[model samples]
Target: MSRRPGRVRRAASAALLSLLLVAGCDTGGAEDAGGGQPAASGAAEVPGEIVLASGRDVTGRGGIRQQLITEWNRQQEAKGVAYRARLVELPGSADQQRSQLLGALQSGSAEYDVVNLDVTWVPEFAAAGLVQPLPDRLVDEDVIKSVAETARWGGKLYAAPFNSDVGLLFYRRDYLTSAGVTRPDLGKDAGWPVVQQLIGVLDAARNRLPAAYAKGWTSQLDASYEGLTVNGVEAFASAADGFSLTDKEGRYAGSVAELQAGLDELRNRTQAAYTLPDAVHSDEADTLTDFAAGRTAFLRHWPYAYRTLHQSLSAEQLGVAPLPGKAVLGGQNLAVARGSQRTAAALQLVAFLTGKESERCLLDAGFAATRVSAYEDGALTCTTAKPAGQAAASPTGERTDRMPRDGNGRPAYARGTLLPALENAVQRPRTPLYGAFSQTFAGQLARLQGGTPPSDAQLAADLDRQLKRALPSH
Candidate 1:
């Protein structure tokens, strides 16, 4: 969820204040001093070492990142390029990750040759000159065109897409059948009203449905980072009306009235049925847990949740659909550190990891792939446990069934649902002050969730003030 950026510093005082307040508390530990120099330049070339600063642990078996890295190692070894990746796990919070990466770059002591960055962080990294811009020849124009646009700043590529993610709608087919309601048509233009009505129908028949299917719908309405960023910002941005908080000119778009209306709609709709009232305070783990436990009839979540949900319920009981509004796109990008001396080798490693073969491996291991070809590859429908092996076929094993389909019957996974959303959906204002913006939004959302019901005018005024202060003119 990181990308490149614009805007310049206003004053020394503001810069110092940001450093003291935001950056000081979150910078991670210094680089490892024990690690010796990077592998020699020509020592069997592929055998060279590359430190990978990962936001998550790569040692975990069956994880997409781990699988991709493992394959890369095998390929490198086979080609006589003995490549070794040492992963330094960083804090998982986006804010913390950005702070740590920025601090490391500024310190010039980070030895990592490859850095896994959130899609949104690309802009900040490029602006700070922390990562190297990808060379034209290394990028696959067709594949990169689809995935690399997010990593660009002023029209230059800064990173390569790693693992792609997007929001998907999940419903209970059994409950829908019991209610005698036909499956809702989830076409490209599906709107909130349609979703609301479907939930309404489910609510009216709650008494007849199983206790676990009583709740009409659920989402991550919590004030946590993920909730705020995804459900609040991403979902709101994709609303038919666009983000109520930001205008087309990248200015404050909504009055307090608009924001309250949006919040009220979200809250009242969920509250009408037996939903988790504290969802506004829950995290991704909690949201996923509730869905897995069958506490709700419908949920909107990332693709990884599909694997976990499949283990808990029969595919027949589960129905996948694209979100009603613009879906939020989330994923990781791989970049070479500007200071690294192994740009060529690192780029080669990145290409191998993001290639069609690696993507196939990722999808087979229960992770989503970024490439369109991977999705179309018949192997995805084949049910196999091996990273790159053919999947074992079952009645429910079809990719068409596993992935959400639009009204037109097209797969509504990352490409169908989120690609358009990225092109037209609301993006967080591309300001260096996003940290402040997110914090303010979270604080205000907490109050609304607590039933404070502040005036829309007041809310808008306060938000405008904060934004202006956060990004004052130089």
Candidate 2:
């Protein structure tokens, strides 16, 4: 989760909880261990205590990971198991956490039993031999098949999915209807031209909607790693098949022409500005906040933004659809640490966290579940609509007064349509050097948006330079 600087303060209680969870697990709350040796070598039985190191702030409200850990601890303790959980919350940025984790692991000072890694880091972590392969007995074939495909390197499973997320198109139902445009049958394989046509229709009728709503579109355009990973690389991958930014074969499949065209459309066609002047430098939270505040008519964001947007706008006014253009797939995964002393316990923890009961808990806490079974649970199907007696009504009464209907006019968001879009969605390049590549890509995209035309030769040269810098020995 991303947050704007000074937009909101971290909740005190949640922050405290985050710290306590981490400190409780640390061997001695020792702040730093400078250049310590790697962990001792031994595959022993489960230890009495287990530590879970995470990159997210668990103290924040709506942190599903924090809630999952807390629930796991409670359930395990009740069953008379002697297991204890300690959480270590790192800074929120993926780069910062990655640097810290690499330092800790290389120095053999990191004491985490199970490490929560971003999906893209699997290849790098596995290549360095910093994480262990999952045991076969603990996870079923289907679960293994789903996660391993996303987190694999050289045909080995390095991580299991912890939480999953993806980009979906959020539109204004009332706006579309008032424009006299019944849902255009863009069909399942809708592309950029179709989306542009719809945006044009909305822009023409902007006067019909509330003044608060924006006349155009909004998405991640910041120059940060997320901007490149989500908007640039993902878009390129979706437009073409077998396109990977990084693979063992070491071939980069992105095209500068396609990337430039897409970025131009984002700027000129939608008239959408970056959250900040250097939006290519911003994070996903910026886009989410803009959409939630009614500043944009259409947005591409993960489902986690659903509750927040629902709280900000009425159902009649809010519309959730698959992204009009190509979108990238995004989600988190779970993995056992190579340095873990409690393999059995760690595997157990993974099983419990990804199980049916835990998925229900996560869904109830306002997070999307990865398990197919959780989607059908009755508890996950319910949503509270805006109170009818509220003084203000949604400009599209279809959205404001009653529970917003899904694309099919059902009582809830369309899960049937949403999940398939995410499952079949494209992903960023799976490279050990994805972080560096994203940085370089974001810079190029920024220049392109500034009216510089991009050429494949220029991008190929830049990528070559980045590859050398990121992987000198390779």
Q: Which segments of candidate 2 are over 4 A away from where they belong?
A: 1-42, 57-62, 137-141, 144-147, 178-180, 184-189, 248-281, 376-411, 451-474
lDDT of model 2 at residue 437? 68
Summarize candidate 1's per-residue lDDT along 314-368 as a digit string, tens digits.
Answer: 6567766666665666678888888776766777667766666555445444455
The CA lDDT at 89 in model 1 is 74
lDDT of 2 at 215: 42
TM-score of each: 0.75, 0.75
lDDT of 2 by residue, 119-141 (tens): 77787788788888875443454
Question: What local lDDT score does residue 401 receive in model 1, on the 0 to 100 scale?
Answer: 16
Whole-model Cα lDDT per candidate? 0.57, 0.56
